[model samples]
Target: MGWLKMPLREGVAALQNSIVSELQRNWPALVTLTPDLLGLEYPGETTLDFLEAIRDLTDSGMVTCEAIIISSNDGPRMVDAALTARGRAMFEPKGRAAA
Candidate 1:
């Protein structure tokens, strides 16, 4: 059980890292937070998993989400997000590393 849990945790962490890195690379673009959009950005990741990663990023304050009503049938939902200052800093080259 413990071994199974370890792999699962590692996989999730990897997915999260991938999502963050992709967002950082695509900085300044208003990325839709939907599973389909994320899947397009990161294929091989299930919609549920991508949604979970987006939730984690939002909770961590690394991104800002905006609610939008897409249609009459659909209610207002968090549809788009953009990286925050902290997230942008992630890609900044370090003092010596930049040289």
Candidate 2:
């Protein structure tokens, strides 16, 4: 059987979409980024990849990183993330009344 493959851009897009969807569902609440949690969400992605994606989103002002959790050894561990106004505007569907 031939192996199925996705282009790099498409894979990245899917990851981004998953992140946006999670944030949309947890709107107004910060989502903690842990390796295990990320793994559960995007099984194919590595922790470093997720971090890079989060960094890209932050750079674009699509999301905000509240805090960077560090280990006692002074290494970065996880990040606390939340969607920004711009992110919400882009991800949230239009013409929906706020409950």
Task: For each candidate in the order shown, give its overall lDDT on alpha carbons.
Answer: 0.55, 0.65
Tell me the lDDT of model 2 at 49. Answer: 60
TM-score of each: 0.54, 0.65
Q: Write the per-residue lDDT of candidate 1 for residues 4-98, one digit (tens) a residue.
A: 32123335566667666666666677765544443433233454455556666666677776753333343223456677776656545566231
Off by over 4 Å in 2: 1-10, 40-45, 69-78, 97-99
RMSD of each: 6.8, 8.1
* Model 1 segments more than 4 A misplaced: 1-10, 40-45, 68-78, 91-99
The pairs that clash in candidate 2 are: none
What would the per-residue lDDT of candidate 2 be over residues 1-99, giving only the tens digit for each residue?
Answer: 865543344355666777888777888777876545544433334544665666667767898876766453433444568888888877778887433
Candidate 1 root-mean-square deviation in Å = 6.8
